[model samples]
Target chain A: MKLKIWLSLATISVFFVGNTAFANEAEETVTPDEELYDTSILIEETELALTEEQMERALLLDEFANDRLSEIEATIEEGNIEEAEQLIEQYEEYLERLESELEESEEEQEASEEETNEEDNEVERVELPDSDDNDENEQGEDSDEENQEESAEDQDKSEEELRESAKQRTIILQALLEREDLPEQAKAGIAKALENQKRAEENYLRAKTEKAVSDEDEDEQEQEKEEEETELQEEREEEAAEQVEEENDNEAVVKAEQKQNKAEKKQQKAEEKAEKKQQKAAEKAEKAERKAEEKIEKAEEKANKAKEKAQEKQKKAEEKAQEEQEKAEEKNEKKQAKKAQENRQKEEKKNGKPNHQ
Target chain B: MKRAMMITCLFLLCACGQGEDATNDDNNSGQTEAVLYENDVFQIEEIDGWSVDQEATAEQEQNVIFSNGTTRLIVSIVSKEQTIDTLKKDVQSSFSKKVELIEDDENYIALLTNRKENIRGDVYFHQGSEHQLIFTFMTPEQHYQESKNQINAFNEGITIF
Candidate 1:
């Protein structure tokens, strides 16, 4: 048994020691100056090829650009100006790729928006004559509008994030340029990169301004079109009213008076129907409120009943415990009395025996 | 019985200690090998001390890198269109002017030395029917000879289809 316990402890200690060593090995990292650094670059290139999305690719390119910047700084610190220059060139290439990718993504988003607008226009053209179908169409339009709003918000958020990243890059580059120990060759590269970053930022602002202008123009055009449509509708209504007046002029006075009275009766009937509908809706609301109140009351009553049952159970348990305690006390008292009686008998026997002696 | 138990405990502890020492020796000498990467083209194993550079492998499926301390072994599988002459040109263009073609035949091996970086590389190219495999083992110039056995062990684990 002791041997088994010792073996188990030895095994456990060995296991823990092995695991700690493995963990330490796993936690080790390779830095840029190491021989495996080129491997790291190869892996990064492979990942870049596999990434499919434009915005994600652009973000990744930005990350790689930052990595190159750090590598350049490290190389410069080690007095390896040639490698720093090479890293700077690579950084420039990454920046160029990132700019192109951002542009492509923005253009794609705009194209998709245009396509959605065209689709909405087509849907609007296919209007149904039935009023119920028109209501459904209106709801569909509302959902489409909501989707457009969400997409617009997403686009704004992405653009803002990109701008923020660009700003950050600029700040880093500016700081690097200001460093007193920076080599002349590296300083030139950083200055050029900083300029490129500023240009990219300006391009983003330009695109945003252009989009805003275009949206304003579209809104203005839509408003003008709506005003024109309303004007035409008013003109058509005026024409119909003139025709009705001419018909009245041609018809007898009594007939026209009868037509007017029939129209007034129809309006009154429509008003009565509307009032009844409102009253029915109000009654339904009241019924719902009463039903909710009854449900709450029922739930409360059930809770009270459960509480009462639990209290009664607790009381019964308490009474049973008290009875058990009292029984134990009575038993203890009887045992003590029996012991005292036996002692008294012994004492009497002793006295009688001594007297006989 | 108590003395026997104490003796058994000491024996167990000594055995465990020896086992640990053996494992450490194996890790240092690159004696143990395990399959580190595999695909349709080929399968390769890494030496005991070496670890796969996961960040690199995660990015590209065509290539994998194993590193042991400052030593690195990079394995890449490319198209068979890469000829020995093209491989030579690639080596010449990438490496320093001091790089030498030490071996030439069915397998082209180049020794690359970069004085500035104080690193040396032994690059090997193997062409199979469907794919061409390139292995580049790099280490500090001072330790290049010491890493030869590890490199050889790593190469022996490669089985190409």
Candidate 2:
């Protein structure tokens, strides 16, 4: 009863703490644009994740990724977006298969654990009176303890593997999120997957904590402890699921508010843009009007200057004509005078004597 | 008279030396004098009876080919971005045939093979500080012997800038 009470208290405390931790963990990155920037990053991470494959399988996967990338490029070149999308889906399926393989191996390990536990229970139930076979019984107990220790180590190792597997899933999720063109349902699907991983991480941590407690309290009835722990874990899982549902509701409400805020911001930005455009248009029209008035003023001034230039040219032409007439008159007068002198000379020659001018 | 005689002797000496030089050039005509061919990357001396086909140098991987009808030299200017081993793998895959490495040094590797009955391929790979150059020489089996000597001359004349 005391153990049950302590376990209950631990469960309650874990609930509150786990809720906060998971809520934080499950917090979705709000900026969709930032998610788009992660595509290349996720691809690089996929490459890094590939380094763990030190075998032929890893090489094959590397080759497969390269080949798929080539195929997708070719499909895109042919302008078949649908086919390219399908190819991407097929390639992602291969990645998902790795995750699923990990899950399946974990399940097989759990099954083996259950089998060992049942065998241990059977060994416990086998009633053998105190007899000469006590040595055999001790050996059996020793072997059982060894088995338990081995299973515990295996569980610890699998914990690390599980963490690794979850990390890989998270990487894939990041890649999925990076695809800005995915449908809303697809985004929701990724969200659900993230929630699942969070829950898995929580359970894993709880299991670790409980294992420590069990180790410390090993003097207690081990079988009853196991049964109680299982029940308590189940109960906690139920509570966690409900808590997740409630958190989802709260998240939705928060998202809706965020959406409304975004919409308001967008509308205000649009209004500001329109007002600025209108103001710019008014300024442009005013500038154009000023330019046109200036151009007309310049043209009119040019025309007036041209008229003045033409009048001056006409006056200059008249003056030139007058100068020519004056010169011609002087030449005519000179010719008449010369002709008169010649006439006088001719008269003298005809008389064959000097004549008075 | 003495000056005239000395001038005549000098003229005779000059004529005899010129005749001998001309005859020697004719006798050694088979040596095939080479001329330096260079562009932005590296310089190679192209030998006599060989010329680059400008039209066939349009491929992205290889930009130049020097040919003498029966024999050809393909030049690929690989950038310094890749390691030497990667360059070899690329060459092997590009040819789609196993190439035997005949010369391996810190700066270069020479790969050769007789791909066909009467045709041979020789690849001279040079790892440079700024560029990796690959020279693929293909020639008929009969000309392969002479082609090797010519290739060596070309290699010796090559100076990567």
Candidate 3:
């Protein structure tokens, strides 16, 4: 029972793990917006291997060629031109054999690739989900009918994407191979790879151009995002400035209003004080006028009384002073006449400018 | 068998034709064991194909091998303050393949051999200035240790020009 339970647990665990693994695989296989390159092609079409005997022969031939070349070089150095030429011929012959063998190997690889491709196509047709299989078959049948229309649309899109990617890869490879530090042999290989890559890129571009134009949505989105961020930053800055302005405005308005209130109160107080001063001034003026009028009246009364008394006294004194006044007037007239004559004489004598005084 | 013998015979004949033929000529030729150049500032001569390039300073007498593809020059300079045994040991270690210490004492010194037999005469050490030269012949191993007086005399007689 324990064993059974353990087996059950193990099986359950495996099932869960397997499911998880399958989920991951499915996730990897099904990109939301991209087509996955199936590795099944490469797996089915394994690289062709050279036959052991052929490899050995090729190695031997290479060695032989190298030895012969060395011998030729030495012989030429030693002034054996004829011997060197013979060795050169042998080297060429061996090289030709090597070329043939290489060609054969390449052919074999092509054959293998074709066979694998066929097998892969067969498997692919059958390996899809039931719905996909039915759909694919239906698509195959309808491909004749609707392929032209569908392909025109699909091709344009695929081609553009493919071309863009190929261009990028070619540029990358070219950049890689162009490095100065790469070894001579590696540089040569890289050059060849670059050439092939360029060709592939060209083909991909050609195909892509034939298809629908690739959507610029991602690029647009990125640009939009950048623009949004910029706009948002600008908005934030505007908001910040507005907020600051508002705060300043609020502060200034409150302060201004408070100051205005203070000024109004001051003005009102000044007005009230002015009005009170005017009233007090009026009252003072009135009191002063009254006091003045009383004094004037009193003085006038006294004057009147005094005048009467003076008149009485003057009447008595005038009779006595009349003679003195006449005498004083005559004396004053004489003194004034003398003074005027003296002043005129002194001004005339002092200066012409003093004549005006 | 016959063909093998013929090839061997041909090889031997070629070798024999190339062997040194100066055994008696060296003795009769009024040749100094060591020839000096530049008024005796430098000296160089072959001993059993072992070439010596010798130079001298105020403090020591230096012997060198002018053999070896390498530009390296090995100098064995002797000073009055140093011992012959030490000098000999030094020379032996330095010129293990090309030179050997034949005789060494307070009053006399000699070096035997100067070149490696199997390494082809491609590599050697030699000493000379543009103005001076000194040459000393390499002594055979068998006679080097035996002829001490003769070796010393040879070394002592070594002069420039």
Candidate 4:
């Protein structure tokens, strides 16, 4: 019996635990009306704060503004005019912020574009020092074209998106304003919100129109600049071509002059060589003639010497012959005298003694 | 029989505790804490009255920003090798020149005032093993002290992966 009582107590405890769990679960479920709108706004603000790009932020703001409008409509449908009025005020504030943001974004974009232009100009100045102005201008035009294409594509896409969103919001607001069952208290707030929306739309349209005009003006300016650049380029090309032609002509003249000078120098050298050859030949001939004359003179002198020697030999032989003849005659006369003296006997002895003496 | 009575009383006490917990949960119904962001390097959650800035988070690869009214909490994970000295230097350099070192410990904390902007920031540096986590809480100078709890709560919600 005690065990049975224990089991019954345990059962009762389990039932109490189960009941508590169910109660907690029921309390956890929350309805949309009970949802914290303030948190939603905080979330929206947080999202906006986090967005770094202006166009993206504008788009987010547009989305949030639409959310507010939907909330206002829901509140109005629920007969909560006070809440609807509050949302309408919030909506107006959102619209104001959106407008300011869009304006700020546009200004920032313009400022950034100006900064890019300045930077490009600086780059052109820095990079193209020795280059021709035409080349520099062409480079600048190329960079400008690239930047414009990129900026135009992005700006056009974003602007188109914003314009579409604005139009959609305007239509939604108008439809809401046209609701027949809207409470009198909510009607004024909605009308005021609608007016604010229209004003924002008008501002957007005006800005877009101005942007279009400005773009047209920029296109015209770019076209004119391009034309000027092309003309300058053409003139520069013509000048370069002319300079090349002149350089070629001057080079040809210099080459011809050089050729003539070379030919003259070659002819002069050949003439000098011919003159030297003639002078050498003349000198050789004169030396041969002088050698021949000296040989002739030497031969004549040799012949004269030979003749004089022969004459001297002949004279010497004659002188010798005369001496022999004289000697013979003397001998004969001495012999005859000796004979005659012998004939005279004693007179021959005396003649012989005189002869010995 | 006494044991059974004691067991029943214990169960009754547990039930009451659960009911009280449920009441507390009801009180904090819409203000539930949730994981606001997660990545390969870290995870962070939304604190009470603070919401995550999705755009700012998406803009930077490893950075997140949480905002509440005029106060903002910026959390960034730097995938760089860092020591205490470098972390201190980073903290000092990350803020304005007028930033003062308020607390120096394992985590470096700094207080910076931008007089021109009328803003004040309480910056904290947490050095991890392979990465450094920087948390910057900024608000108007007037509300700097009032936003301390939010800053602390945000700090508590950060988890480095």
Best by TM-score: 1
Residue A141 shift from truth in candidate 2, angstroms: 90
Estimate, for each residue in A1-357, the C-alpha lDDT of model 4 and write its tens digit: 999999999999999999999876433322125322232343345435545667766766776676677677667778877877887888888888888888988888888878876986687567655767768677767987887888768877877877787677766766665565777667777767766766666666556655655655566557757866786697588657756876767677776676578669758866886696578656755665565556556645754564465457657868888899999999999999998866676665667654432
**What DockQ values do the models have?**
0.02, 0.01, 0.01, 0.02
What lDDT, from 0 to 1, does candidate 1 have? Answer: 0.70
- Candidate 2 docks at the CAPRI level of incorrect
Off by over 4 Å in 1: A1-31, A250-357, B1-161
Best first by lDDT, ranked: 1, 4, 2, 3
Compared with the true structure, model 2 gives a TM-score of 0.25
Global fold similarity of model 3 (TM-score): 0.17
- Interface RMSD, every prediction, one decimal place: 13.9, 18.9, 30.6, 14.9
Model 4 CAPRI quality? incorrect
Best-performing candidate as measured by lDDT: 1
Question: Across residues A1-357, which tens digit of lDDT does each residue of candidate 2 receive?
Answer: 999999999999999999999875323211112212122222222233323222212222433443444454445556556655665665555444444444454456556667876876786677476767768877987987897788658656645654665565555555554444555654555545445544444444444444444443343347446766786697588657756876767677776676578669758866886696578656755665565556556645754564466557657868888999999999999999999999889989998988763
**lDDT tens per residue, model 4, B51-79:** 87787666655567778877887776665
Quote the chain B TM-score of every prediction.
Answer: 0.69, 0.62, 0.27, 0.67
